[model samples]
Target: MDESANKMNKFDVLGSMNLRTKTLLAIGLSAFILIVVVLVSFFIDPTSITTDWSIMNQPPSLEHLFGTDWMGRDMFTRTIKGLGLSVQIGFFASILSSIIAVALAFLSSFNKYLDSFVSWLIDVFLSIPHILLIILISIALGGGAFGVLVGVAFTHWTSLARVLRAEIKRIKTSEFVTISERLGKSKFWIARKQILPLVISQVIVGTILIFPHAIMHEASVTFLGFGLSPHEPAIGIILSESMKYLATGNWWLALFPGLALLILVLLFDIAGENIKKMLDPASAND
Candidate 1:
């Protein structure tokens, strides 16, 4: 009986270690892929995407990995460049959105009046059609990367803010919070030392969750002619331009970039999910 118990314990430890390793691997792989894509985009030459009439509209071949576009520019380079721009936009927008969410959430917990107003504002934003609101915001801001950033940052915060508000409300009712209040701790002190630490995990997860949406929305608005300029080699621009060539059997134009965007989004989503699981002790083993 003792020997069997010892064997079972050893097996359990090995299984636990394996599970931890798999979790780390999943997150690391996703992060590594994304980092590589971003780095490639950042380091690639802008002139490499310039038109080269000699190689125009060539299908995927050994000489050209993703083929040449109508402009004869290397599609692979353009795709990477566009994705890199999108990643930058998405990263900044998500960070901005997370900041807004965390700020508003904490503010909403300060007073009933602020809470009511913030709640109503969140509802107003949420009730609008997402894309329409984004377009309007983008157009209002002059229709460029800045507009897309502002649109996404402003629009994406509602859900995360609502969640943080609820978490803060719950935290306020806890004994420690009550004791802190009784101990003459200022609201700022309590917030900085207590509420912030407790809700940080949620903030992180929320930020990660917002990233994929930011990228997709940025691409969508750009595609519809309401975001980035046509001169820019944005993923949206690539896709929009590719539409004209699809009927001519030039399928590679859209396919490769579209797949690249899809893969990037999937990787971000997987990374977010893995991080969330890692942060949650209850689900960490799973």
Candidate 2:
């Protein structure tokens, strides 16, 4: 009876947490899951996922939870490895894209002519379909992990750049920033010291939000045969390979990996949205 009462008290405390606290907890949990996936993939035995003809096309069971592919590769292991690779790619791509956004945002803050040109450039990039641009850039760079990374990084920065540019424009009009300019502070100095700090939360939220898109695009491009190499244990490659066997009622081949990918993407999306909510002044009290 005492133990039950204590458990209820714990639940009550959790229930009492405000939205901001809950958002932080959600972000932390999401980050923890992603880290665990990456680490598990890093440490898993290669032989666990390697093909074994005798076990080919086995369905899910105790010995093989996610079943085996047509090549007798453990779908569970492949899915985990694929997810880890996708997460790594997305992580790096998001960071690179954020850096690009910051640089362009700052560049646009210098003068009216530069700002106009930068805004125009942002609009031009936005005008193109992201998938088409990514595919073209990936092909031009000789399609592989590096190509995909570059393509995603370059294409994902426009929205973030536009956001940061608007924030910088607003910050420039603030009293503190105007005072800094009158005191003979250089444009770079003011931007670095003043505007950058203010817009950092936006940058972080933007990067997190871009992560799912990066993973999905990487998978899409690879599935279409323009991203990662077929030899790689990427989610896209796995899904692409599964397509051949899918018509034969080998449902597990595509089902588990695709579902896992969807879940992973949703996790990042939830984390990003929660983080954005926590950072938003308008939603602070809620």
Candidate 3:
């Protein structure tokens, strides 16, 4: 290669090792841990235990790493179960939201009238606070984990739609897209062949970025008695139950679950940031 070309390629590679990509790698480690926690919980009983009141409320003893709740249930077990439930809600809801966002984004580019209408709809959705909308939807749907999933999915689509729309608009004007248009390719053909591939990385980044939000929001709503059913073995439900005993000096009741949530959220957040950097055209260009 020419010296200039080689130099440019080196610069691009160095820039691609950006903050966002590094963050994504860190987040991936968290995801692996979270996955192991879930698998263990599924294979072994999250609720199975011969209660040992002697271990109750102990702080990180070798015998009981996370200690025991007031009910003598293993805090470690409950933490895994709660984290699993929260992750499930996050995963499903984020997938649904990403699909909705992608469809609306393409629809916005399909026709001018549809574009205007979709833009307006996106604005309307964006104007609402996601948490409140999620709560309202939960109540409307009778307030359960199912409701929380649907609620968060619906409310979560707006920002993604906006991002995808902007990204789509950019993609549609690129050289290959222009060339395809000049050659009389069908809109669907151009979208599939020229547009979708270009914007896919952004979509992936958006999906990952929203996952933690969905999980946290689901937990929050459930904890407040609006998302997951109380009887369900969810992290939020366990947290809510633990809150009542917090003043009784049984702090381990809530501490483990909360820490689990924090770790998972931070991991996903960093991963998403990294994916964005890796996908950035500006960095790639540089």
Candidate 4:
């Protein structure tokens, strides 16, 4: 009895550690970066601090970190705010896109015609230029972050849907799924007891990978003046507005925001890589 108890305890510990250790690490790093950025943005001056004379492209200095813009607004503060907005857009867009993709995929499980139509739709979207679609959607949505959200959500789901469809198709054929069906299990019962448990990790992995793409397209759309409005302080808007002041030798406006965008993208990419590794059983077990 004593030996059996010890064996059970050992198995319990290993079972708890059997999954997601790597994913947690990536998530932790990205979460830390996101938290730090949000905390720092809070202390930034939210309004214009520069006088009229200080307007139109002041270089970086003691008071102005990223320099002053053409309107004499604090560029540094605006940049920070813009970044915060981008993250918000990315987070929500990714979540919504993932859900839609997963749902569409799950629906395909029920109908052959629906599966073919969904697959064709994904192919069509994948054929179009994501940036152009974003611009068009942004214009139709009346511009700014609403447009950004529309654009990102509209364009972000195609690949995710494809990925999820593949996941579901593969899961449906697994032995557990087959066994459930032979036992006269309900669709929901099979999905809940077998399919979901198996495909959930892959779905999560795809979700993380979608984030960087969402942010990249969002920034591109905004930079083209079709995303978040100029004064609302999104990174793309800042970059767009920075063009007029480019000759003033105050390059920090565009430069800093661009770098921030880069860092954020890279952070997401790293997070995705870690997630992929963790979700791959061959790697996760090691």
Candidate 5:
């Protein structure tokens, strides 16, 4: 009875907290889980996952947690490695995309014509299907990790750029910015001193949100044989190879890796939304 009362009190205390506290907790939890996954992947040896014909086509069990594929490699190990690679690619791509967004957003602040052009460019990129663009770019760049990275980076910047452009436009009309302009501060100085700090939170949220899309698109292109090389232990490659053997009752092949990919995406998404909520002035007090 005492333990039950204590548990109830704990739950009540948790339930009483404001939204901002919950948001911070959620973001921290998601980041921790993702960091652990990446760290674990670094410790895993490539040779440990090599094919072993003796255990080929095994089902999930204590001995082989996610089961063995036709190549007799551990699905868990492969999935972890693939996820690490995807995370790395997503990180770099999202950073690059954010940089692109910041540059274009700043450029748009220079004049009305540049702002109009930037708006038009955003619309043009938005109209094209992302997967199609990523595939084309990946293939054109010789169809490998670098190709996928560049494709995802370039294609994902449009939405963030549009957001930042609007933000910068609003910031430019503020009293302090006008004062700075009148005080002979250069455009660059005004942007660096007054604008960048205000928009940085948005940039961070945008980058986090872009991570899932980047990972999924990278996996999709690789699965379709246009992103990563087959030899690489990518989740896409694992899923692509699993398709051939699913007919033979090898259900474990696709299931585990797909679920891992989904979970990783969800972690990024959850972290992004919560961080956005925490940073947003309108919602921060909720």
Candidate 6:
């Protein structure tokens, strides 16, 4: 009886935590699931993704789950591998973009002149259609993984930069920061010790928020034939190839890969939103 009562008390305590903590827990679990998928892909053999003419266009069955593509590749393995690769690219792109945002945001907060210039730059990028800019940049760089990385990295920074800029401006007027300045602390010293720490959480949340957009944009550019090469088993390429077979009644070709990509994107989206809410004091009670 005592052990059961203790277990119930633990559950009661968990139930009493603020909404932010509950959201954080959900985000952690979602992230863990994604990580497992990425890790599992590493152990799957490369040959499994190669063409096998004997299995061509086979529907989903016990022998080949998710069906076999026209090229006889296992759609299940391909989808997992493609989604894993997308996640990797998205992770790197998000980090690169976040770094750019942090650098510009710090520089912009330095003075009114720099602030106006950075704001103008952000406006310039924002004015251009996102997909168009991505296509232009990817083509300029010769349309490969490198081009996609550069395009995604450069284009995704504006919103996060703006967020960081607002946060830094607010922190700049705080009493402790003002006191530190009067006490002869160098600007760099104060920033390193105080400002950066305060902004780190926002930076982290911003990076997480940027991830799904990066993945989607990368997939979009690839689908439009301006991103990754055809040889790669990217989700975009899978979906693109599937279109040719769709009219012939091989719906599983497009269905499974598309659904997998959607689910992966949605997982990241949910995690990002939850992290954002958890990090926001205004949402603490929600």
Top lDDT hit: 5
What lDDT does each candidate get?
0.92, 0.93, 0.83, 0.80, 0.94, 0.90
Model 1, span 20-111: residue lDDT tens: 57778889999999999899889997876688899999999988999999989999999999999999999999999999999999888889
**Across residues 1-286, which tens digit of lDDT does each residue of candidate 6 receive?**
9999999999999989888778978888888989988997777776667888988999999988899999888899988888888888899999999999999999887789999999999999999988999899999999888899889989999999998999899999999999999999988888889999999989998999898899999999999889999988898998998999899999999999888888888989899889878777798678
**What TM-score does each of the candidates earn?**
0.93, 0.94, 0.85, 0.85, 0.97, 0.90
TM for candidate 1 is: 0.93
Please write out the lDDT profile of model 5 over residues 109-224, one tens digit for every residue.
99889989999999999999999999999989998899999999999999999989989989999999999999999999999989999999999999999999999999999999
lDDT of 5: 0.94
Expressed as tens digits, the lDDT of each residue in 140-214 for candidate 4 is: 989877778878888888887887788888888888788888989988787677777777887787777888898
lDDT value, candidate 2, whole model: 0.93
Our model 3 lands, by Cα RMSD against the true structure, at: 7.1
Report model 3's TM-score to 2 decimal places.
Answer: 0.85
Tell me each candidate's RMSD, in Å, in order: 4.9, 2.0, 7.1, 8.2, 1.2, 3.5
Better of 1 and 4 by lDDT: 1
Backbone clash pairs for candidate 5 read: none
Superposed on all Cα atoms, model 4 deviates from the true structure by an RMSD in Å of 8.2
Per-residue error (Å), model 1, residue 201: 0.8
Q: Once all C-alphas are superposed, what RMSD does model 6 give against the true structure?
A: 3.5
